[model samples]
Target chain A: MCQLLGMNANTPTDVMFSFTGLATRADEHKDGFGIGFFEDRGVRLFVDHHSARQSPVAQLVKTYPIRSDNVIAHIRKATQGRVALENTHPFQRELWGRYWVFAHNGNLVDFHPRLHAAFRPVGDTDSERAFCWLMQELAKAHAGVPAIAELTRTLAELMPTLHRHGTFNMLLSNGQALWAHASTHLHWVVRQHPFGAVALRDEDLSVDFAHHTTPKDRVAVIATEPLTQHEAWTAFTCGELKVFVDGQPLG
Target chain B: MCQLLGMNANTPTDVMFSFTGLATRADEHKDGFGIGFFEDRGVRLFVDHHSARQSPVAQLVKTYPIRSDNVIAHIRKATQGRVALENTHPFQRELWGRYWVFAHNGNLVDFHPRLHAAFRPVGDTDSERAFCWLMQELAKAHAGVPAIAELTRTLAELMPTLHRHGTFNMLLSNGQALWAHASTHLHWVVRQHPFGAVALRDEDLSVDFAHHTTPKDRVAVIATEPLTQHEAWTAFTCGELKVFVDGQPLG
Candidate 1:
């Protein structure tokens, strides 16, 4: 299976540590990798059909300290689409005068929803098709960008239809909040005050949050699996959909 | 005035030389800089609110050697928008299953058009407003993506309306072809067989095309002013709209 990683924070934060953990897992899933960083209303999306383990783009992501409030990343194993540049995720589109980014971990068998609205998939992946359908339905659900709670409620209503097809674990962000849904394996952790050093499960690298972050900083990270061994990670239920805002989960 | 640069080629070609020439001019137009490169249907967009002469992102563009068939780049003087990341161009949006990139060099005065369609300006800039209006009208002009020739003809009809507002020099690309329209200053040059060495107009750097490009390779480059010192550059007439496909301008 492909792997997924996401972050939501009250302030802009760099994801070099977590991304390094994710990139180490690229050994198994070497089709492609992509990461999107949301800086206010703008997004810097770096996608390569090359493996994150070796791609220079991935190297830039690891070394550059691009602070963003929301981030979504994926390492692809090519379950549904060809290993082409156009098929690389995370996919991005504009809606309601803002950019929306999406990345999927699991596979869908034959899911193809009606894409009647303005959004369309440039790629042939089912993930891109699902993202387009979500944008279309979101556009129809509101005249303009509605409240985050309303969007979460609408998305809650739409998730089951997509979930019925197959595994639908995914992460989405519109720079305001991050929404993550899981039908299979997914885990998360929240780091706050009194931060301690943590070690990566797949690599020898570790970082002490106490040195790098402020006491008021709060960060929530979600991944297909626990990225670090020492952190207290929480696993999502089989059919859970959660919305994270400002580093905290909003029920 | 801001500066514009564009490239359309018969094959995927690295843009380091032309972009370096453009970056040297960023010494004055240091409000921001952006570049978009199309590889097949996928695009790699690098934008920074910092000057291209010093921004780390711009440094990556210069060193990475990412190749593409179509490209659009801008060095902004911030004539209409704040010097923020969100306001940086070339602006991108998806329409009819294809990503469209746009960058404008000149200004428009009191040129707000009705934006009743799906495309909207995320940034508060006259250039973005104009681009959104163009996308909205183009969506109305055709139900789906028109042929390149048809789209160029439609743009030819649409340019006069925007040109009358003020200076509307711009470059647009949809990965298939590049369209350049000028209300004031714009120039283009085509490089083909028997390529020779050329020097940058703004910098002392020079590169011999014969060592880098194949005999069959053809490249069309568009800029606000000529980028090379020795090349024969053709200046666009006022209100002229030109379409380039496979490195050649279509009559």
Candidate 2:
């Protein structure tokens, strides 16, 4: 199985600590690694085909300092395609003058859907296929970018149909909001105001969030697993979907 | 927030489908990605610090064909440290002539523990500190490798103590079995003889495990959230720990 981690916040925050713990599991997921972040103007993306465990670049990621407001990460265990660069995840596309980022965590069997738009998959991953399909659906739903509520409703309608094929856990963002859905497994946690200390479950490290975050800062973390062992991470019910904006859940 | 996905099976089953979808989220987590797998002979590892969203290599992971019995994957969103390769996860250390893989999802506050063994952290991340600490603990517990049960008990004791510091949810494996502990948030699902179709909540995709898995195969998926929208995923209670082998909980 692969893994995913996402963050939506009211303030620009760094995920260096949380990411350090998650990346340690890449030894067996040699397929690849990728991460995307939204900064002031656009999205910053980094990816490598080498195993995070073995890749020097991956080490740089842990030691290098990078900050952002919204972020998503994925580690691969390669079930559908080959271990190549073109097949990486967090597929991105330009839509409505905003860069949209997407990542998936399941397989689609016989998921060859007709894409009605110009958006094409650079990789052969089923994840990319689904991403393209989402773009197509969004395009067909409204002539232009619709309101968040409308977009959510459209996603709710389109998600079940996609589930008919296989596992479809995914994370999506347009730099303004983050949309997450769980077909099988996904989890999330929100941190705000009175921040506290957090420790890594995989590693014996800890951090005092209070030291870095502010009282007005609100942050939401979504992932295949809780990054910390002590926090009250919430689990999304099967078939549940949610959208986050400025670190708060959007209805 | 970062993500982790793990699979334990009764037999040597593949986790390709689940991983394919999970890898898609790497864009927001472009910090890095990593995966670990345990086979009959030894453990296999792969990882990269690239964003799965755009990394050609991550795309290959989704499309690349690989199978394993036990698997763990991670996508990173840098929080505690820099985005470097050595900091990438699913950190591996040799113990008792077997390779052990550890992946963490949380951050530890002021987790600077002293080490008295050869095990040392190559990265500045606290996750590595925990890994080294675990190794050191194991080395101190018994001169030679003890039984799995004994090791598990030691871990249980060690885990709760760590949780006192902060969130410590994590997955640890030594090739023979998987030990999972959840101090705050975590979930698990078991798929067996009666396989069914699963849809991803994050993406418009699905897969019928019945088609790919045999009746004898029993798979236990552990994650921060349920990856499929249709499957029943059980949530791990606060301070709950379990040992999984052959896709079932151990006594």
Candidate 3:
């Protein structure tokens, strides 16, 4: 199985350290590696089909420093398709006058759903097909950007239908709020005031957030596994969905 | 806010298509993107600090194809860390002779847990700290490989302790099974025989997995959100955990 990681915050922040460990699993050390993040106005992405452990680019990524408010990252292990650039994770698109990002962790049985005019797939994997369909549905539901509550409610209703076919765990964002759903397994955690020091699982490193940010800053993290051995990481039920904004769950 | 995606299968599968859509939101579109997967022997990874929508590498990922049985993917909006390589998600490590992959989507407040071991952080993100703590705990719990049930129970006991500090939702895998937990929000779904069509949420695409897999194949997906418009995606309850192996949840 593959791995996933994500972050949401009340203030703009960086995810360099967490990403450093994640990149190692990509083909660089074992498989390829990829990352996506939002900046001042747009999104940035980097991917290498080569193993992250072996790739110079992956190494560079570990040393390079960048920051943002929302972020997503992935590492690859070929299963359904050959290792190639076209099959990387953390896909992107334009929707509702803003950029939308999506990533998935599951296999579909025979997911050949028809598409409307709003969304389309650029790859051959089942994950991409599902992304396109979601965009299509969102477009059909509203002509323009909808309220967070409305959008989330719609997604809650649509999620189960997709889960019926196969595994359909995914992450989605529009630079405003993050939406997460699990058909089988997923986990999350949020960090806020009273900043503290933390260490990494993959490397012998740690940092104190209190030294970096104000007490007002709030942050949320979601992943396939708990990053820390000491901290509590909540697990998602078999069928649950939630939306997050500014490091807090939407009402 | 950031996004996450994942897939688990009874047989080998690929997540290229799903990743394609997810990568788009990293920088120009979202912020950053990363993906992780488990191969036959180890974990593989791919990540980029660019947006999946505009990064040349992101385009290549969509065109290049890679497959895997277990996969995880993410897209970023940079709520926690900088836009550099070190901050990407889907971090990895080696445990028990197998590659263990982890990714996070929430933040911790004042989470300065002191490490008893040498685990450290490579970046300035809180996610890395959590990853390290988890590894430390695992190392302390089992000197060598332990039974799945034992490991699961140990994790269950550890979870509440970690949750006390803040929200903790995450995913973890050691190329054997995928474990997920939810604190605020996460979702999942299982797919088995009698596969069907699935659509995408970010793009226009679809696939028929029934045409591609054997009847014995079973798969499970976990994510921060649902990726399809026409399928059923289950949501995880607050503070729940589940494990998926060979496309089915372990009891």
The per-candidate TM-score of the B chain, in the order shown, comes to 0.99, 0.95, 0.92
> What's the ranking of the predictions by TM-score, best on top?
1, 3, 2
Q: Which ten contiguous residues of candidate 1 chain B have the minimum total lDDT?
A: B78-87
List fnat, each candidate: 0.54, 0.00, 0.00
- Candidate 1 yields a Cα-based lDDT of 0.92
Give the whole-model CA lDDT for all candidates, comma-separated. Answer: 0.92, 0.77, 0.71
Best by lDDT: 1
Question: What interface RMSD does each of the candidate structures achieve?
Answer: 1.1, 19.1, 16.5
* Candidate 2 segments exceeding 4 Å error: B1-251
By lDDT, rank the candidates, best first: 1, 2, 3
DockQ: the better of candidates 1 and 3: 1
Model 2 C-alpha lDDT per residue in residues B111-181, reported as the tens digit of each score? 88787554667567888788888877887776656787888898887886677767777888876788898
CAPRI quality band, candidate 1: medium
State the number of backbone clashes in model 2: 158
Best by DockQ: 1
The candidates' DockQ values read 0.72, 0.01, 0.01
lDDT of 2: 0.77
